[model samples]
Target chain A: MTVLGWTRHRTNLPSGVRSLHCGDWTILVSDDPSIQTARHRLAAQVSCFDAGLDFLPTAPAQNIAIYDATSFTRTTDLDALWRKLSDRGQFSVAVRMAADQEHRTQDGRSWLKTRQAQRQRQRHCGTMLADIVAHLKLPTTQPRHTENSASCDVLVQRDDTNRVHNAMQHLARLMQGPPDMRLCVTGLWPPFGFVDLTSKTEAAE
Target chain B: MSLALEMATPQDAIRSSDTALVDVVDGLLRHGVVIRGELWLTVADVDLVFLGLDLLLASPDKMRPEGITR
Candidate 1:
């Protein structure tokens, strides 16, 4: 059996889901090898978030993810926060992940020129990353990044949704990243970075 | 004696109002965790190949946007 992820209960199981009981959670598993089944479970996991149920997903990380109700913070407040700010009650604004990466052209006139252009775009993406870190007040060293590509997943504080969207979108366009990189302002998701895995570690001990 | 991959990036018109479409793609595809490690490929319950792999799941449109990159 291959493990997919952990959930607080056996509430929302997709096809082939095998629930393994844990001290405070259930491990969702599959009969297929981890590779084949993880993808199927991921698609199911994306669509659903219940107020009463909490889930921990996988990175081929397996179902043994040690989870307890206390280790994770609920962003259900995020939806309420977004609703108060914007009337978009169905959706929320705590987009946990923001990605910006170098842009490239499919075909170009010259290799030298394309390489130069690619590097320029990368610098812009790097700058955009720096801007995001500052905007969110995310604590990190090397406040500026000049890498060829960058991406991050972080918890957003409850600020105005439209403000962050507009600010990011504006700066992204000004930075002139690849179309998608310029355009990618993702939506609210489970707080992957914020959760603690002490339960998993304790289980191992 | 050469191979090439060419993909047209989507310049589709997306209003600021419909960030939902873009958001859905980002959350479902980009946000999904990737599996990276060594593996054994087997057939008929016998291991046939060794694989060192990093795997990500996404639709063609999302993965091929512009071109492939890490």
Candidate 2:
């Protein structure tokens, strides 16, 4: 499984490795227009989910996470773009997993502890989302109505029921807000970023 | 006079409930279009924990725990 796309941090790509993943998900960074167009169109296919108020589930049979720079440029401003693709977001996900799960080793203890601390800070922010929702009570909308940002989207295979459900719920919660702060879920998508790394690694050979 | 909890303090006048801090935090927590392929993008979400650290460092005078920075 692989996510073919572009990244702003192409400088960080590992030697002989164009894509990267921690588990069932893989990310590919690129700035190609054709790829970006395909990604944008994919977002259009799945228009029921929202970015800020929903939680995304796991990938389907074979999932991929693609990031294209051309698409990211067409959507958001500089600050928002940088923040959207920054390692900060990815890091948060990792830390969250560690905190939510109890898998820790002595050698990885320091990293684990630091991640836990970070998770606490982020949780503070996430918990406050309730206040933001109460104050704004934003409407739920499709991507067609709003301006695009990072062309944010997710695609899951038809059989990947668990992941699809999880992604939908997660995205829904994050999409909450007032009308001015509407959440944009493009449409149903094809699994592009969700993939089992171990499975793929074994297949690559 | 003490500051209202609802409102940020004078020193943090630039800070407001409407601030993008949390949004930024959320985006870092879970934003960006993800794809899987031979060309992969490995983003360490824990790296965003730095945002909290940055927040704490910026307001050391407040002397809050990493958790309270949010």
Candidate 3:
């Protein structure tokens, strides 16, 4: 069966949706063969149900826990974004970027191979990600789909359903990336980076 | 900060890099769900099909190069 998401409690679901009884969590499943259809269904349901908040959309491999969102009284954009997010049900945002790949240290600089440079850049990207995540004070997970430094996915979350644009703005301002790096703020995403999906079944296996 | 960053919907952010709409595909691929099946896709009137494709539909982080861990 194709799994949609896992929730702690069961709720009113539209027709064609079914559930799989798993430990403390309710695993939502469906017969829909279309993966795209499953995605749209999941995205639409996230805002409606608490269980839909954490799932996969190029989610990180690890299960990161979701955190309580802090009350925010920011500017007009954030306020508006929150309202829009509330209406649209956008819950998460991803910041993808390319890191600078250079080893300036004397010994490190000596080994300026292609792979070494790439590794250095990846390290820099990881460091930058940690710093940003720390400053935002939000839960985040590195997406497994991240192909390279150019497409690293850092899922940021907050207490409000998806009222994390201000954090995004702050993140954007703090990001002094290259001109070619384009920052796209996408939403209503599960902090798939934020919740541990490991259930008793996995442990039993 | 007075910097007006554009807001976009997920649909607009799908393929293009510079459009402002809300992007909601947090992870467009299914995480940890590998569909071992065939694929039929069309791009610009071109129909493409693949057999025996083990679809590890998730983040590229899953497709990390050998010896590299994120």
Candidate 4:
């Protein structure tokens, strides 16, 4: 199995890697896009019954998948991307969140404050990622995929059916909460076989 | 006239920093999967701005560069 890495600009491309733009994200696969795209577009969304089975086709060898969280707006968008990656046989997926410092103003005094705030935010993100991983029962010892100064990456494998299910379900629950709470799932894709259970509560409220 | 004084406890300190909750909130704000919805202002944004300012104010002494203690 090949290990996956994540970064802003593409790096260490393997021979025969094909770049694919999935929504706002970009990825490099080993096979041709025409074949992969048609296969994924035709595959129906796998339901809970077929949850454990890997319905999507495996990605060709030495494929690199990249997703940008800055422009992510929907959980389904992420799901589709994850499904595509999974289908291509890419077991490991890295989700990256752009650092807030990029949006800082140049004023030194204010910038200092923003940087401090951003650091605090980054630390918090690290801790929360820890919690989510724990909740999803994912392994904690996965190697770091890539290094980026402006963002943090959380690496998850696709093979663990139970862990993937837990992660997806936990994310769906988080999304059901108020908007502020919903931000935690911002860069993650909901797991396969996920259903929104909070809509009824919201509607009743 | 007399006034009663309350003593601070360890619990109070933990509650003040709220390290875990703060980290979770920070993570939610900074990362995770998001659902697209119609754009609108919500109390969360207002609260987050104030929370950031509060955190900034609380650690003003730590804001300075190393070796420059206020």
> Chain A vs. true chain A, TM-score per candidate?
0.48, 0.22, 0.50, 0.33
Model 3 interface RMSD over true interface Cα atoms: 11.9
Candidate 3 global CA lDDT score: 0.41
Off by over 4 Å in 1: A9-18, A29-38, A50-52, A60-110, A138-149, A156-181, A191-205, B1-70
lDDT for A196 (candidate 1): 29
lDDT of 2 by residue, A78-185 (tens): 344333332211101111111223334455446555455544544443343333333333221111000112122233233453554454345445543322222222
Q: What interface root-mean-square deviation (Å) does model 2 yield?
A: 19.5
Clashes per prediction? 0, 78, 25, 16
Rank by TM-score, descending? 3, 1, 4, 2
Report iRMS values in order: 15.5, 19.5, 11.9, 23.1
lDDT of each: 0.40, 0.28, 0.41, 0.30
Instruction: In model 1, state the lDDT of residue B60.
Output: 47
Candidate that would win on TM-score:
3
Give the chain B TM-score achieved by candidate 1. 0.26
Q: Sort the candidates on lDDT, descending order.
A: 3, 1, 4, 2
Best by DockQ: 3
Which lDDT tens digits does candidate 1 get at residues A29-135? 66655333323444334433223224554432222223322232231222233223221111112211123233354543243344455455556655566665566
Candidate 3 residues A14-103, lDDT tens each? 455665554444555556555334334444344333433333221222211211011111111223333322222333333344443443
How much is A12 displaced in model 4, in angstroms?
31
Off by over 4 Å in 3: A8-11, A19-27, A33-117, A142-163, A199-205, B1-70
Q: Top lDDT: which candidate number?
A: 3
Q: Write the per-residue lDDT of candidate 4 for residues A1-205, one digit (tens) a residue.
A: 1111111224444444433444444333344344332112112111111232222221111121233222231223445544434422211222223455455487654554555555555444444444545555533333221111111223344445445545545554552221222122211221221211122333456
